[model samples]
Target: MSALPRLSTIFLAAITTLVAVLLYSPLFVPIVSSFFTISHGNVDWSSPTLSTYVTLAENHDILAALRTTLIVGVCTVILSVVSGTLLALYYHGRRSGRSILQFIIFLPFLMPPIISGLALLIFFREIGLERSLLTVVIGHTVFVLAIVYRTVLMRLQSMSRTLVEASYDLGATGWQTFWRIILPNLSSAMVGGAILAFALSFDETMITILVTGTQSTLPVRLWAMMRLGFSPDINALVALILMFTVLLCVLAARFLIPRQVATERT
Candidate 1:
């Protein structure tokens, strides 16, 4: 709060702003080009059009890839949520090996994507699994499992043990306690995890590229198209995706923010 400290804080804020601008500069180029004409590696400032959006609608291949990405995202969310919640429940307490196994569960996420993808690719080939959407789903699930598991586990850890005890003292069976008491508390965390998982799966490119077959996700498709130069439609698609991602983040925060915060504010 002192003057010198305040100046230091201002300098730090300025540095952070510059870093953010540097990071977003590349994204601005595509978005800017989407609205205007580009000629000879430069944007034609006088011309502005929505032709790219029209082109995007007509591009069936990209649309198909987009569909594939959505499908994979949904599948990944479902699988990761189920498995992660189960793992959290199973390993919540009473085990010496659980920590080691949890580390193993998280290894794929901690390791580089190329390494994880290569390992999975080889594992699949050895197990006779084909290169396809199914493989992509599995890869995505593995990659996202750590996030889902961590989120659910944190919620579980934060929940008061007395709640479970009180439920049982009221003559609730184990199943009843889990279904009525535990699941309700976990619902928000599960939803938040699902959103995070879906977002990661939606944009996952490295593992998808390695494990995918003929059906490509949007990111992989975009990567291939970039080699041939992107049209205006790609920028339109990027803009739409950015908007959607922001919306998803807002929804996720809504779900994940603790109810106690709302109570306090009110």
Candidate 2:
């Protein structure tokens, strides 16, 4: 009986290992290609070089697109964080037509990206708004607003009502309470949400492609280039972006996890 149980446990462990390998193999293919040469379904075992990195530096068009992407990402992060936080505060406990409005706020994120992209494209045309980086920023803010709002609201709800009540009980004015207590407590969540929003904006391509005018973001540019096959430098850029995204995720987790654990303990 003991031998049978051990054999079954070993079989389950082997199956789990096989599943993990299957899931990560697709990711491994790209990371491997970024550094080493692959030909005819085989990696060259000779050596690796930084030639791709050098080539990426000279690719001014792609570099320009990357700059544009960064600008849009920053703008999206700022707008979404500010607006989402304000909206969350405004609607936290109030129920006056807010449920429907909140639903509208979340609709863009809940809908498919293609649908949201098309809707925004049409809306911009109706409003005579030129399809530019500004339009892209608007699209990204709308798409990511839900994430920021949800993050901030979760933090706000987790906060002790006693903290705010104590502020008032201690003779602090409304602005004083907000500035000293509420804002400070919510700051970490806002920062984490901003990072998440920026990361999403950096990689956003579907809505951006529809709403973009002359300037395209990095993901859009990559999509265009991918149709004609990727160059070596593009691989280098992908490697860098993957690393940056991982860093952002780490930073976001660092901020979000502690707040969540504290909330749970409280």
Each model's lDDT comes to 0.90, 0.89
* TM-scores of the models, in the order given: 0.93, 0.91
User: Cα lDDT for residue 17, model 2?
Assistant: 97
lDDT of 1 by residue, 39-151 (tens): 77787889789888888888999899999999999999999999999998888964778878799889999999999999999999999999999999999999999999999
Judged by lDDT against the true structure, how good is candidate 1?
0.90
What clash count goes with each model? 0, 0
- Model 2 weakest 10-residue run by lDDT: 29-38
Tens-place lDDT per residue, model 2, 16-102, is 999999987776666667777667767675878777778878888889999999999999999999999998898786879988878
Clashing pairs in 1: none
lDDT at 82, model 1: 100
- Candidate 2 lDDT at 31 equals 65
Which sections of candidate 1 miss by over 4 Å? 1-4, 260-266
- Provide the lDDT at 214 for model 2: 100
